[model samples]
Target: MKSRFLIALALSALSFSAFAHVGEAHDHGGFLTGFVHPITGLDHLAAMLAVGVWSAMTTRRLWIAPLSFAALLLGGALLAQSGIAFPAIEPMIAASMLVVGLLLAAQVKLPEAAGAVLVGAFALFHGAAHGQELADGSALAGMVAGTALLHTAGIAIGLGFRRANQWLPRLAGAAVALMGLNMGWSLIAG
Candidate 1:
């Protein structure tokens, strides 16, 4: 138990450090950049991980939310690539973290369709925000693959914590939520 708490604390602390790089410029032309983007950005990382945790908590289906998120994320990127305008994408991305983080912390269970729609909606914003920067086909594929990996990690952690200590995942969720709130405030303040 002590070790688990320590691990969670370390993750929470690392998340804060990771959050500092949200808007830094990265080479946007390759698979490596797309792959590294989400893991390096706390806003995307927390939201994606929360989606997986929430999906794991559901009783019906495990893949629906993640699939919905991935598909819609791609669609959003496509829309952006095609020159479609999506206003306030950054704010929406931050909001995704807050909303998803709260849902994960509460362990909210929704019908699969509702879950898909909810996750998908926020996913569009995330997709658009990054999509504008990703112009390469391989980069898009890399982003999708990287996102899928994060979802898998979240699901695994969710399942493991479910059997070991229920509060641990919830604690992680709260930390994510707090990070989201901080992110949102920074956007507003700056």
Candidate 2:
């Protein structure tokens, strides 16, 4: 238990450090840039993986939540490209990460549609961020594919964690939740 907690703490610190330096949000373009974008932001990584973790923890339809997230994420990207601004996107995205962490920690259960809606909403903010990067054509394709890969990774982690001892999952969830809180606070404080 002590070792697990220490590992979680180290991971949380690493995640926080990863997001501390942001040169520009629009620095990503092309296939490689788009592919790497999701991992670049700590909040985004947490949110995406949390969705997978939540879905795995639940007994509902797993694929629906992720698919809905992807489709609506595309819509959000298009909306952003159309010159529409969702002013609270940054904070909201941060909030999504925070909420995802909370849900994971709590192991909350909901019906399929509700879960879909939850993840779908978060996906919009994520997609909007991608759109802000102005990625097009191959770049957009790469991002979508990359996102799917991230979701896959999340699912794998969720499954693997479930198979592990109980405390590890909770520890990981708590770590993610704390990171989300820190991320939100830093953004709001700044």
Candidate 3:
């Protein structure tokens, strides 16, 4: 636990530098852009990765969880483009990370339906944020595709690690929760 916390702290410090490189030239803008957006934002990265880890821990249907998130996230993005309002979205996004992380860390085994509902709700908020960024004319397709890819990568990593190390998921969850706390503080302070 202590080692995990230390690693998270180290990664948190590195996040700022990670975002700074977003404007630089990269490979394919499509997936890379989407991938960068989620990882660059502390809150989004934590929440999305937590979803992956939690899904791996709780369900054997690995693809279903991420696909569900992607579909609903696209729906949310469409809503945002249409100028729909979901108040307190940023805070909700942060809270999702905290909630999902804690749930995974505690190994909460929720029913399938309830888990789906929870993940869907959080995915909507995340999608809205992505849509808003896209709507603002910030590399729309690339960013979306990138984020989706990153999400897949996170899920793959979670699934792979979970098979070997039982403690990995909890460690990931705790790290995610710490990131959420940091994001929450930043939002409140800012």
Q: Give me the displacement of residue 117 in model 3, in angstroms.
A: 1.6
- Cα lDDT of model 2 by residue, 1-190, tens digit: 9886778564756446234232234645688776777767667777777788777777456777777777777777778777777667776676777777777778778888998998899888778877777457566766777777777787788888778776655666676777767777877777
Number of the top-ranking candidate, with TM-score as the measure = 1
TM-score of each: 0.87, 0.86, 0.76
lDDT of 1 by residue, 1-190 (tens): 9967766674665435234232333438789878877777767887898898878876367889998998898888778778787887777777777788788878888889999999999898888777777868889888898999999988887787778677766777777777777777777887
Once superposed on the true structure, which residue ranges of model 1 sit more than 4 Å away at CA?
Answer: 1-27
Alpha-carbon lDDT, every model: 0.78, 0.72, 0.67
**Candidate 1 C-alpha RMSD relative to the actual structure:** 2.8
Q: Each candidate: RMSD to true structure?
A: 2.8, 2.7, 5.1
Q: What lDDT does candidate 2 reach at residue 151?
A: 77
Those runs of model 3 whose alpha carbons end farther than 4 Å from true positions after fitting are 1-32, 136-144
